[model samples]
Target: MDNIVIKQPRLYTPLQIGLGSFVGGPIAMVYLLWQNFKTLGNQNGTQYTLAGGILFNVGLLLLLPQLPSNFPSIVIPFVYSLTALSIAATWQMRRDAIQHSVHYRFQPNWRVLLLSISLLIVWLGCAYGLGIWLDALGIIDLDGSAITAGKDELSF
Candidate 1:
């Protein structure tokens, strides 16, 4: 009797998704989820993930400033990571298991690392742009005028 070899699809584990969420925030979560949906040939899921991710990101931006100043910095990342993990497990894990069982190979860690770093850079660029916009609108000053003034007074 000959043994047949079966090939399994590569997918990201829920834990990996969660870590990506933690490191790259919501963008990474959205991307990982979208990729899974696309791979599974779930067009509806792909569309919904994109739309939901946009709404969630907008809502998060709007609500973040409303949080109390004393809010712990760690809580936001924790919440998003847990949410990503839950979503990945609920929507994709079942298919992942049903299709490949224990034979599935996980997506490479290098891809996740590259994604996290790339998204982090994108996030920082957005922040910088927002700062420039706010400064232009006179909402906040980004220049060093106040520091210069203080130094001038002290020098006298």
Candidate 2:
């Protein structure tokens, strides 16, 4: 028997891939937090991921209503902020993973990829729906009035 090593497709650089994973991990954490919020009361071991997810989703949700409506005005800055956070978090995690001798394997598993993509779409869709529900119920205001006046007025 021969030892054969099969190479996998590389969609991005190690850094890029790590960053993608890092970005995704928090998003996953956010979904977990939302699940917790839906099911259980505020308890232990949910704070860190919950807070991070809430902050990240808040930043993202702030941009959604303005997306395609305002364009280059508001969405760009929000995107920039998201990118900066993703990159910074990715860098930190990558450094830690390297130090801990984490294995960086790039296997092109269609099942895993499809499942992940589907899960992401569902998660984002649910978040958007939740935002809309909250907005309608006045539980939270997407118009940013709670933050500042004229904040939600889409400006170019």
Candidate 3:
């Protein structure tokens, strides 16, 4: 019998997965928000937004390890803190809105839906663009490598 070799596809690295998730998390959040806004009405918007924002921040934190070391630590903390504050404030506002019932009617807001869709598209596009830019700058290689013949071989 003759010896034979087999090759298997490589899985994405942690950093790559994190970056991809970071890019996707916000977009999906926005879409869900938009859908909630369209279908659920204003009373539900604040609750949905608050919950979605928290989840988005958590996803961002997961991506922190993949961030470039050159990134400023202060920026991440500031953004995270701001997001947390916003969530808290929104929760409070929703509570007040529910209590007062000051003719607060729930209505469909199309503008917000449009904005959400646009923002999601822009965000994902920018993420992909950044990946390309990083590759161009040789900061990171988007295409991974495979082990072959007892050596690492770069894949295109």
Candidate 4:
């Protein structure tokens, strides 16, 4: 009997993971990581990654409103993006080296792009829905009265 090794059909490159993180945030990065784990046939990694990712994102959402008004907006994105890239570089790269060849085919870039866009839409929708719910509950008003008016109101 000979040892048998099966190559992955498709795997995402680190670049794709980084871009997905940049556009879709930590959740998207986690999704990509989960996909990689699933593809590699590591059921435990897939499950843990998903659970951890959800918890992290939930914590993040809860903590976001507590940030000081003076806090820089870019910091959060920068931190998550860097973290995702680091994981891709270290973990995924090691897996690729062992399980895949130099000529291995990666998942298409468009798939990442689509996922990013879809995640963006979902995030925006959730935010909007929350805002509406809060408004209905008298917690916050979604009206534009709080916004400062521009000098000129021209037709689009």
Q: Write the per-residue lDDT of candidate 3 for residues 40-147, one digit (tens) a residue.
A: 245576566667766765566446547776988567544433443354344323434433544333223343345445655766675677678766886666664322
TM-score per model over all chains: 0.74, 0.38, 0.37, 0.72
Superior by TM-score: candidate 2 or candidate 3:
2
CA lDDT of each prediction against the hidden true structure: 0.79, 0.47, 0.46, 0.74
Show how many residue pairs clash in every candidate, following the order shown: 0, 0, 0, 0
The lDDT leader among the candidates is 1
TM-score-sorted candidate list, best first: 1, 4, 2, 3
Q: Model 1 misses residue 87 by how many Å? A: 0.5
After superposition on all CA atoms, what RMSD does each candidate show versus the true structure? 5.3, 10.2, 20.5, 6.9
Tens digits of per-residue lDDT for model 2 on 41-126? Answer: 43542565567656866766664564664456544434543553454344323334434433333224453345345655765786
Per-residue error at 150 for model 1, in Å? 17
Instruction: Please report, as a residue range, the 10-residue window in candidate 2 with the lowest summed lDDT.
Output: 8-17
How does model 4 fare in lDDT? 0.74
Scanning candidate 4 in windows of ten residues, the lowest lDDT window is 146-155
Off by over 4 Å in 1: 1-8, 65-68, 94-104, 140-156
Cα-lDDT of candidate 3:
0.46
